[model samples]
Target: MDKELTSSIEKVRSAVKEELTHYLAEQRDYLTSIASELIPVCDALEDYLLEGGKRLRPLFAYAGFMAAGATPTRTDIRAMASLELLQACALIHDDLMDGSDTRRGKPAIHRHFESLHRQGSMSGVPEQFGAAAAVLLGDLALVWSDHMLHNAGLSHESLMAALRIHDEMRIELMAGQYLDVREAGEKEFSVERSLRIARYKSGKYTIERPLHLGAVIASPAQSEHGQLLNVLSAYGLPLGEAFQLRDDLLGIFGDPTVTGKPAGDDLREGKRTVLMAMTLEKASAPARRELQRDLGNPTLTVQRIEELRTIITETGAVAEVEKLIEGLATESKIAAQSSAIAADAQPFLLALADSAIRRSH
Candidate 1:
């Protein structure tokens, strides 16, 4: 399943790339090529947008299109590319909101602004202004993404569906972010609690909406949509949740160099993720105390981080969570295989389910 889905996604990537390039060459053109002041900023934004990502949402949208036997067209490609732009907008804002310094091996947008402000002997610039600029830049990308979707030359129904999905994604993700921020300071973390956060924060918005958007674009009729939506939800929900769980594990244990960020960033942020919840669930009282004391403390030493890791492991939480992810992946695969969805989509759905539990980042 993973191999087949990966092949299809790779095939769709050409469309995504072409659309992004066209957006730069055409829509981003200056009034005066050499004399224009906005060209540099536009170029910088283009570079930033093209920097790095898995292009997962766009791939999902394309896969759904193919599953529904929609002919590949320029409009389809353009519509799909807008998903990536929407994702980029979300990431830029997410990084700023998290105050993250890096993403995909380079400085995040705000950090980039800050660095540019500090470079070439530029001084006396307030660092807060950099973050402010990034916020506005993200807002621009968000609006641009919506515009791209709207002008994709699709049927009014399809365009409306796409726009609705985009709007719902933004709102739901913000709600999830609020939940995340609220949960970080709590002590009584549970598996159910963490799962609730995962569903809101990543599962539905990340997987379901993209699938539905494409499904609607490809086959918006009521008679056709119910089955497709159900299959996609079945295939995406558990996989999305497991994906976030794996990411949570990686947050604490992954190599910072490979992850392209500081290790223990999630810990410092005190994310109330399933792994952390499980640690407390499986640990003894004193172990919980140690975890609470050192887990999120930025000033904690390396020794303390290691100790926290050991305690988490000793409680058997990590192993338990790993098994749960495997279970969820299997469940997704089963759902994909049994779903009364389009025959063309089954293979891709199964492959996505199988691969969701295997990603390293």
Candidate 2:
């Protein structure tokens, strides 16, 4: 990305962080007023939200709003910032479901609470206590997402309009998550099925729906609405898929220091990603047996992970996923150049696509 685009992205990120800080402070005050015992919950949320994140969802939403030929107010930016809370909800639950130990180099929410339980000598299973806390925190984040958007100071019309898209996005996300968990439990894996899960789980809400949320908030005239959305979808959907594919590759091959997770964490989690599906298709019987034996083994050794990495590369799945990412990125860029996109917004959208595909974590 050029300096200008990079600067714009940073500016958006800063603004969203500011809004989140302000909103969380208000909520913190409210929670403390209700009871001092809620301090840990508030503290954890603050650390998770403010510490580090790409803020991609808000950035996409801002780009989408800009594409509608409308300037954004601070309030508009606050509404965009709300997406981060929703993302947090998803991630906290995801870590719990995947039995992840850490996130961004810190204990996962469930693990955090579990440690709290142990330290407090609280009765009952620490693990179960941790799981319950994580579930409640995730639910709190979901509720806060709605509250932030509703109070974001958009006009009634825009809020109503945005809510429709918001509701749809949430529903789609839940459905996608269900598919992801279901696919993991199945004995058979298909590249086609895995791709479908990717589309729903990580693709749509991450990119397409955020863009649509912004576009809808712009409140375009009825006649322009359908066409504008269609055009944005052309750009967002493929790019979203590409983004998720990049994530999948990183899950297996990424540097632990940069990704803030153990190497081959996705393998240990038994993620049924498209790359894994493709590997199974191309691997020899012996290689397939090796993979099936230890793919989801949490106790897997570093040497074993390296061996699995070699097996996957030898199957040519890594190269194929790279090719797919490149193709989808090209398609997104081409769609971004359409006349339907606001000229000012087009550059940022293109830049966002490049960033999405190129991120290390």
Candidate 3:
């Protein structure tokens, strides 16, 4: 089963990657005549888009195209590229907001430009100026993504729906961020609060909206359309929750070398995660106090993180969460199997169901 999934994903991934590369090359030429200054900005956009991991939004979009019984035309390809551009924009802004130095094992675009500035070379752009420049670059990608989508061969109605999805994704993500910030400051973080943060912030944007946006683009015709959307929601939300849960575990416990970030990042950042809330709720008094005191400390150490892990285990949160993750995966598979989504899409959908909860990073 795993082998078949790996093979299928590789084929889909190859197609998606080719489409992205073709789009980037076309974009590079388009921007070249504008200015030498614009060349570097275009280069940066191409770099990150080409270098990203997963391309999950585009993947979901691809699956949608398949489910609609359409081979990807130029328009479908453009939509796929647009999704990645939007994701790139979000990541740039997110890294800056989080004060994140690296993304997927490389210096983030802003920091990379900042380094070039600090080197005291030819042009003498200030480091802060470079960061500002990167911010503008991200904004351009965000705007351009919309432009590409608007120009794609979608009906005006379908395009509007996609735009609405884009708007909603942005608002929900921002709200989720604020919720996390506020929750971190609260004396007692609840399990319910943590789940809400995951759903609004990471889950909805990552899974739910992407899947639905694809459905909108496919524009199914019949009573089955509503049912297909509902099925996707039922599958995506839980899978998203599990994805975040695994992320919470990795945030504190995963290897920094593999994850491309410092260990204990979430612990130091003091994220009010679902895992933490669940652990807190179930843990003994002393264990709870230990978590409360240690969770957000900027000076947290590996040894302390290990101790926290021990305490969480003693509370059975890990076991409980794992069980829930399995249940969600099972449910996602069941939903996908029963859905009216095209038969050809089943393997891809099932692949996602299998992978959604099992990935470590």
Candidate 4:
């Protein structure tokens, strides 16, 4: 990404963090009567919210507002910041489901709670307690996101308009998550099915709906709103898919220092990503047997991981995915260039498309 675009995104991230800090403080006071012992829960929520994230959803919301010909105000930025809470909800639960131990170079929320239980010698299975805590925390984040959005100081009309998109975004995310979990258990590998998972799970919520939310807040005319949404969908949908594809690759091949997770984490979790699907389709019988034997093995060794990586590469799945990413990146750029998006917003959107596909982590 360009320095200018990076600076803009950082500003949004900083503003969101500031707003989250104030919101969390209010929650601490509001829940004071509920139970003093719940302080740890509140603290965990605060830490997870403030710790680390790309804040891409908020950035997209801001850009979408701009693209719709409105200058974003402080209120607009704060409203968009609510998306981070939603992201936290998804990620916290996702880590638990995947049995991940780390996130953003720190212990996963569930694992964090597990460690706390062990340190204090709390009763009950530590793992079960951790999982329960993570679930509640994730739910709390979801509720808080709704609170943040409604209290973001937008006009009543704008709030109503944004709420529709917000509701659908959450629903789509849950649907996608369901598909993800279901596919993980299935023995079949389908490229089409995997792409559907990518579209609903990460694609729409991450990009298209956020853009819709921002455009709705700007209150464009119906026809103009349609145009803006069409343009954004063109840019967002493909870019979002590319982003997820890159993430799948990174899960298997990226540096732990950069990705902030153990290598082959996705493999151990048995995530049914498109890259894996393609590999399964193209590998030889012996290679297929090897993958089947170890793909989901928690005890898979470093040597085994390397072997899987080699098989995936040799089967040409990596090359195919790279080609797909390039095509999608080009498509997104073309859509941005040809769109009726406002002049000022075009560059940032373009830069985002570039960054989505080109990022290493």
- Could you say which candidate leads in TM-score? 2
Per-residue lDDT of candidate 2, residues 1-361 (tens digit) = 7999899899999999999999999999999999998999999999999999999999999999998988688999999899999999999999999899999989999999999999999999999999999999999999999999999999987888898889999999999998898898899778998889878866789999899888888864433358778888889999989999999999999999999999999888778999999999999999999898888889888888898999999999999999999999999999899898889999999999999999899
lDDT tens digits, residues 78-127, model 1?
A: 88788777777778888887778888778788888787777734656747
Instruction: Report lDDT (Cα) of residue 35, candidate 3.
Output: 68
Better of 2 and 3 by lDDT: 2
Deviating ranges (above 4 Å) for candidate 1: 1-5, 30-40, 120-124, 185-188, 223-225, 299-303
C-alpha lDDT score of every prediction, in listed order: 0.75, 0.92, 0.74, 0.87
Clashes of each: 2, 0, 0, 0
* Runs of candidate 2 exceeding 4 Å displacement: 223-225
Q: Model 3 TM-score?
A: 0.88
TM-score for candidate 1, please give it: 0.90
Cα lDDT tens digits, model 3, 117-189, are 6774646566576678678877987887777777767777667777777778768867877787688678877
RMSD of 4: 1.5
Give model 4's TM-score versus the native structure: 0.96
lDDT of 2 at 143: 100
What lDDT tens digits, residue by residue, belong to model 4 across residues 1-361?
A: 6788889877878987888888889999888769998888888888888877888898889888988878788898889989999999999999998888999889999999999999999999999999999999999999999999999999988888888889999999999999999998887888999999999976798988898888889863444347778898898899899888998899899888888988888787767899999999999999998888888888888888888899999999999999999998888878777557888888888887777778777
**How well does each candidate superpose onto the true structure, as a TM-score?**
0.90, 0.98, 0.88, 0.96
Which numbered prediction scores highest in lDDT against the true structure? 2
